[model samples]
Target chain A: AQRVTQPEKLLSVFKGAPVELKCNYSYSGSPELFWYVQYSRQRLQLLLRHISRESIKGFTADLNKGETSFHLKKPFAQEEDSAMYYCALRFMEYGNKLVFGAGTILRVKS
Target chain B: DAMVIQNPRYQVTQFGKPVTLSCSQTLNHNVMYWYQQKSSQAPKLLFHYYDKDFNNEADTPDNFQSRRPNTSFCFLDIRSPGLGDAAMYLCATSRAGKTYEQYFGPGTRLTVT
Candidate 1:
């Protein structure tokens, strides 16, 4: 079965420190990956997609096909960056349904 | 702004009672989806509507049902609310294509007693 895994349930980093949220997936075919973020009391929003290859809010993710990973990274963590991040895979076979990982809670402490 | 909207930001219901959560989108997307997100967990796909065609997840409980009256509106009906059903219900919309980037609404948090 195709599955997306976010190994870190919670990650804490001091402000100005580099941050990385690890995401891995198991799929037989080409995978379309995305990173979604949800801040406190805010609706979930798309942070970035692998196809877009664009950096948003100082966050970037690179898809490593050989490793089957798409890890989200930021050069310097901001206090406001504290949020829940989810890694999702688009399952093309099932009307392009999004299968999401367990998500990582990133806490950037000041 | 073109956005997805879910009504009743918070809902409380008694056990075995039926409740309906509504969603509307101004984006006019071709697809709408409902997700159940429990605390400290990832959002789970409950069902979706491609235009007017409904698709339910294989593992979705029979107690959950959905309706899309038109392009801009969708509803999630829980037949009998249970304590385990307490969670945040999210509504999202996307255009039909290979590049399916979904836009989500501010979810409705459901509480069952």
Candidate 2:
């Protein structure tokens, strides 16, 4: 079974503080991880994927196979960065469906 | 802009009533998906259409059905909606080879009264 776990439901931080959203996955096969973000009154959008390995909007996530985790990290949190973050695992044994974690609400207060 | 689009941002229907939600995409992607999301929860995949082939999740109920008449359009039909069926229905599209990155539309919020 492929599953994702985001332990924190709410992560509050002050502006300019470092932010890290923890995510862990359970899968038997090689894993493909992605981060999706939904801003207030906006549709969910792709933030980044583990395959790309490129940072987007000062946010980056590294896939850790040994630990079975892919935690999203940002050096500094901005007020505009507050949004709902979801960690998803792409399972291909089926038709390549994404299994998402419950979600984490990151609130960056200014 | 070429993007995924969903109709009726807000829909209210009586319990046991049949409702149809529409999704369209201008990206011309090969795969389109429908998901149900409840408050403060992850989006659950109901089904997806890759071209003309449809795939339904094992846990999906028979009360829900989907259609893809063409490549750019898909529809989700709820035969008899229950109170539990009320949720945000998200429509998404992605290319065949690169199905990892999905483009989601503004979801339709369904209310079952």
Q: Report, for all candidates in order, the number of backbone clashes.
A: 0, 0
Assess every candidate by TM-score. 0.95, 0.97
What would the per-residue lDDT of candidate 1 be over residues A1-110, giving only the tens digit for each residue?
88899999999999999999999999878889999999998778889999999999999999999999999999999999999999999856755888999899999999
CAPRI band for model 1: medium
Error of 2 at B99 (Å): 0.7
DockQ of 2: 0.84
Candidate 2 chain A worst ten-residue window by lDDT: A91-100
Model 1, CA-based lDDT: 0.92
- What's the TM for model 1? 0.95
Off by over 4 Å in 1: none
Q: Categorize the docking of model 2.
A: high
